[model samples]
Target chain A: MPPAHPPVDTADVFALLERGRALSTPVLRAAVGRLAPPMDTVAAYHFGWIDAEGRPADGDGGKAVRPALSLLSAEAAGSAPETGVPGAVAVELVHNFSLLHDDLMDGDEQRRHRDTVWKVHGPAQAILVGDALFALANEVLLEIGTVEAGRAARRLTTASRKLIDGQAQDISFEHRERVTVEECLEMEGNKTGALLACAVSIGAVLGGADDRTADILESYGHHLGLAFQAVDDLLGIWGDPEATGKQTWSDLRQRKKSLPVVAALAAGGPASEQLAELLAADAKSNDFDSFSEEEFATRAALIDEAGGREWTSQEARRQHTVAIEALSRVDMPEHVRAQLTALADFVVVRKR
Target chain B: MPPAHPPVDTADVFALLERGRALSTPVLRAAVGRLAPPMDTVAAYHFGWIDAEGRPADGDGGKAVRPALSLLSAEAAGSAPETGVPGAVAVELVHNFSLLHDDLMDGDEQRRHRDTVWKVHGPAQAILVGDALFALANEVLLEIGTVEAGRAARRLTTASRKLIDGQAQDISFEHRERVTVEECLEMEGNKTGALLACAVSIGAVLGGADDRTADILESYGHHLGLAFQAVDDLLGIWGDPEATGKQTWSDLRQRKKSLPVVAALAAGGPASEQLAELLAADAKSNDFDSFSEEEFATRAALIDEAGGREWTSQEARRQHTVAIEALSRVDMPEHVRAQLTALADFVVVRKR
Candidate 1:
């Protein structure tokens, strides 16, 4: 028999994000509003709700992808979206917390086309604000006053620890000569996958979903996170400068050891050998700025010729497929399933 | 009528600390063990469980005062001391997390007579390990899976936010010329009082105490924390370097705007004006290294002559009395209250 409601064709991805922002922004704002003084001001600036001078400025906050997943996961558990607001706000807070700290640690000057918090304020404010937001996430979750909230809080905290572990691994990789594809994946899984997976399942846990169902949703989100990263790595190297708001060959210029570079090196081709030597020499040099556009282009071309680009493309598709397959195991409403699937598709193919 | 269990005249402060260490160290170690490597290694080193080379070292950890309070709070709530191990472990983790980050932020080179984590490992590790421990603290609480655990988790996280806020205010105070005594006390309350209050009350919350009892205990902890900080500020300038394991005039050398200094500035006297000028000159100098013992001693003598030393000592005693009075509002074992009182007394009078 046909289902009462057939699955919608792919979800309208932008509409889904708008819906997420609408539902979660109020709760998110109220939570961030609880921060004290300059920390509060710095956080507001980081979120694009205000400018460095503390005046209200409508700037680019993030896409709210994690919040969307959290809200959808509540629907997927046969609960109302509002049931997921705490989890949604918590994941959003944690995501920004990481971003604030990572921007400082990586010495990034700009994000979302504006000066970062650390750049505008100082490194101390960045660290302090990040710590404040992280604490706020736990407070929001545990304040819900349910056993389910306790369970969800535990999940969120554990995932947060894994996220920290992943960041440490990424930082360590920066100084290394080589990182295996396996090690890179593991790091990305911890850094990005863990939080997304938690975001997907925490709402379900809060909505009283059983362990088995939450686990399946987590599996789906974990693969989607990998797919998301793969696409992000592709954009880092090959996306149009206008579209990405980055210089040509941005990752190459920065010597980021992302998926494509790691896979290319691991592939062991003539082009890979040349690419390795070029990279090693570039790394040893003190003045990377001395290199011209041709130098970065050459590195990018070598990486592509070594099958890095194609392998990453295929890996993204494979992970997307796995994510979809995992979603099929849960007995969610057909339309809700469609939204999650569409979100995964969007992540795998987004340009920025 | 005398209670069946007579109030002990006073607690042996060191013996109380040793008992706390015995009860909480195993749980603390186990919680930290869950952290991923390199992070785990860094945290172990920070806790003095291992040396910089990763060899086991029997080194000074800390006083275990927070853990003792946690354990004792459970007993005060009519629960076994074992009921509070999770709270004890969690607070210990939080205290160390603050220390790890503060050391990096303040550029302290040493702690507990050993090189700081950022000194031995790196700034990045110190930040990451601190974050990991903070996350672990929430995990330890929520994983207990009790209704009381949820309540306690909420309290701890709220306290943690205040602690971060306190740190931000403290950092900002560093760059300022003059800070009022009110502002200094508020910052100290947030930085030191909030966490101690959480430590003192969280176990009772977890042991199923009502909000009123917990609130009373928190008041006691808050005042005790202020008293403790006052003693610490005094020791920073006046204690022998061998006793504090710091240079003579340690806070002065760092240009810390601590309570005594603020109070002295607020006291309107000839000595206050002289001390302020010396501090202003010191602040403007690019070469603090050129300042001799005589210079620092002169500054200290001027501060003392301005009545800053006397004011701070009286403030500590006043706070200690308030802390003891708070205990009178809560119904608990007489011996437990006696121990808490004795702990507060020890803190106000401790030589180191």
Candidate 2:
């Protein structure tokens, strides 16, 4: 089949994301600032805007990718980007809320080259701040005072519920010795896809789009999220630490059951059998702290030899194509459509 | 001045609460049932409705006092109790969310004569379930689908944020050697008062009350919460473990800076000095696990001798009076006003 549309360039994606970030950052900060002190200070530090002492810092906040999607999705629904700021802020707050709590649950100490909130502050404060931000997200959506505010709140809540469910499943997965690829994908769909779908559809809802357009945007976001997670799984195993800001082979060292690892385990080849033996031996020894760098590298090579890496990469491309098809379902303005396509491409193709 | 109103009978209070619970319990269950398992199982266990094995069990969920207040407030605004079901459920869900997370943070193994969610499951599931419940609360409110739904969400969010803030402050207070009475009261107001006020006002808003009436109901709830917390502080120090489902003198054993303790520390009397010396010695010893029953008894006696017990009782009564006066500011039907009055009296006078 001939190409349905020209591929989106990386430069266009960055420029569009930069524009969305500029508009959404101030609104997000103001919403977070509405929380009382200590919590506000903790949230600021988590956002990479300030140090623990409340002084301005040089660290970067996250890419603001979710909010950018909200803004672009809003524009795609034929509304001004400003009209989507509330939805953008809501999604961003929820995203950070999950991040703060997830770090505590996983016992992670760092993120984006900064100490995690639970590390700088105590776990109790991190939990409370995550809650405050979650509540603040609902408050901001209601304050929008539009006719669609009620619907927006409902949508956000639905997404949040799924997000929590996904987290629960992910935590449970860590204890299980074997997990199917289907189960892993379902978990990712809830964990990542739900919020991203909310981010995409919320803008359309706020813009008063028809149900057909909103559904199409949500579909685009769901497939994009799956592709994003697949690519993230690949990066967890093989990407350069400098580009990803994560320790080399960090996932393998932690014995994480990522997509590729699970796929390799399920493949039933000789490499897969050997990989299982190695993992089982590691579990029995329980000496994760003394795991050498070479052992981590060997696990990565094993996953590749079992064809898990190739399968995951192919799955990412498949999902990316489906995401583009979903975007094509909605006849948005050419520029807006192109930006959405570019963002989806960036999600699957990014180095970080 | 003479008493502004007749004293409320406790029987009447329970009757009113029974009616509200009968009306609201089914709705609350249905809302919680919407969650996916094991979240549903965890929530059910947290609510004391079931065992960890998912079988029916004999356990009390709670007093259902907040839901009763919500329903009564709705009736005060000339609406049926059914109209307040959403608000009641929302309040109850948020209450459980706080309880689940607080139990994890405080490391309390028991609540309501049963294992806490964290103890029964684990901290990760407890945290995830709390997040799920919080989201469900918002979902319930938005599903009300009235013009007031937006306003209700905003009100609920505000109360939830303060509740989280109060929890954060309470955690921070545990590390401080001294906390002022003023700070203690402020924290109580945020922690307990905010949710009670929301419970009182949300019904009025749902019933389409004017701002004045809603504010009066909120004020009543605020004072009632303070009075309730004061009574709880007394119970923490002196109540029977059989009644409170907590260890005898639990707060003192943990060196909690509750309202009465803070007030005593600020009194500057000989008894205060003695109490301070005892507490300082305990801190220096740093042997909490081996703290004897005699030590706990002695600490309680010192606090009472310092006038903390008497002062707290007087403060509770004063707050009860203020709460009644706030209720008088609104003119509702005679029966509804009496129910509200009776509930307030029950709150202040309860032994548990």
Expressed as tens digits, the lDDT of each residue in B1-352 for candidate 1 is: 1112233334487788888899999989999888888888899998989999999998788778899999999999999988888999998888889999888888888788788998999877888898999999998998888899989999899889889988988988999999999999999999999999999998899999999999999999999999888888899889777777777898898899988899999998899999999899988898897889998899999889998988889889888889999999999999898889888877876777
Candidate 1 clashes between residue pairs 3 or more apart in a chain or in different chains: none
Write model 2 residue lDDT over A106-206, tens digit each, in one string: 88776887778998998888888999989999888887777686777788888898899888878878777888999999999899989998899888789
Task: State the DockQ, from 0 to 1, for candidate 2.
Answer: 0.75
Error of 2 at B173 (Å): 1.9
lDDT of 2 at B113: 74
**How many Å off is the CA of B125 in candidate 1?**
1.0
Off by over 4 Å in 1: A1-11, B1-11
Show model 2 residue runs off by greater than 4 Å: A1-8, A52-54, B1-7
Instruction: Provide the TM-score of chain A alone for each candidate, in the order shown.
Output: 0.95, 0.96
